[model samples]
Target: MNCPLISLKAGAVIFTVLWTAWMMWWSGAYSTANLVILAVCGAAVGYVWYRAMRWQFERMGMLPHKDDRSAQ
Candidate 1:
């Protein structure tokens, strides 16, 4: 149950990081600045998605309950 969701999340995180790196290199020029910028942007999006998914799951009672809002 939860394992599938956890696995999906893990897959998404790794996929985002790897895809960002690959896309950076695949586009040619190989600029460090470009890679860094894109990586940071990708990371931010991934984090937002992760948080949103977790929040929804928590609301649905699919995840353990906790007062995580104050931490944010």
Candidate 2:
């Protein structure tokens, strides 16, 4: 199977942005402190999610091998 076109960095960024936006909208009352906390938490969650998915995909051979220089 072809590897997914999205890179880890891109996936994390996309996830974080979407997550933060969704949370902000859901909360309905925004504050500077809330925005900052949401952004930071979103990024951290996104990174962790990316790593977990990457590991699973690699194990399943759905992602490029780490040592494959031409994979990227």
Candidate 3:
């Protein structure tokens, strides 16, 4: 639902899918291995983002934005 880790994972998956598709369409050098690498990188970014946001929210005593779902 509204879990930071889950949101991060979903964001990573979405980023990987979009990036993989873009690479396949625009770059002839793209490969399955490269896609996998990008996906991994995306996952890492998402994880870092999630952790940072969680820390910020906890420190601030607030969610990112209670009324702004788009921020997440």
Candidate 4:
């Protein structure tokens, strides 16, 4: 079944957003510099994480190929 809520793209976005929000909250200080740093760092980390997860999922046949429109 193709479930949007459980897809890799959605997962990445949700993970990134939640991770960034958590880091901001955990830092306990909302300065502009801190926010910028946290956002940039969080996005980088999130991207790396997403790539890793995508690779693993593809290997395991859990995610479809980029050119596979039928999978989408």
Q: Estimate each model's TM-score.
A: 0.60, 0.75, 0.50, 0.75
- lDDT of all predictions: 0.75, 0.82, 0.64, 0.81
lDDT of 3: 0.64
Ranking the candidates on TM-score from highest down gives: 2, 4, 1, 3
For candidate 1, the per-residue lDDT at 64 reads 60
Local accuracy of candidate 3 as per-residue lDDT tens digits, 37-65: 76676567656766676667756766555
Question: Which wins on lDDT, candidate 1 or candidate 3?
Answer: 1
lDDT for 17 (candidate 4): 90
> Between prediction 1 and prediction 4, which has the larger lDDT?
4
lDDT (10s digit) by residue, model 4, range 1-72: 366325766778788899999999999999999999999988988888889988787777776766674655
Best by lDDT: 2
Candidate 3, residue 30: the lDDT equals 66
Candidate 2 residue lDDT tens string, 1-72: 243736766887898899989999999879999999899999898988899888888788877667774655
- By descending lDDT, how would the candidates be arranged? 2, 4, 1, 3
Q: Give the range where candidate 1 is weakest over 10 consecutive residues by summed lDDT.
A: 63-72
Which residue runs does candidate 3 get wrong by more than 4 Å? 1-29, 63-72
- Tell me the lDDT of model 1 at 63: 69
lDDT of 4 at 22: 97
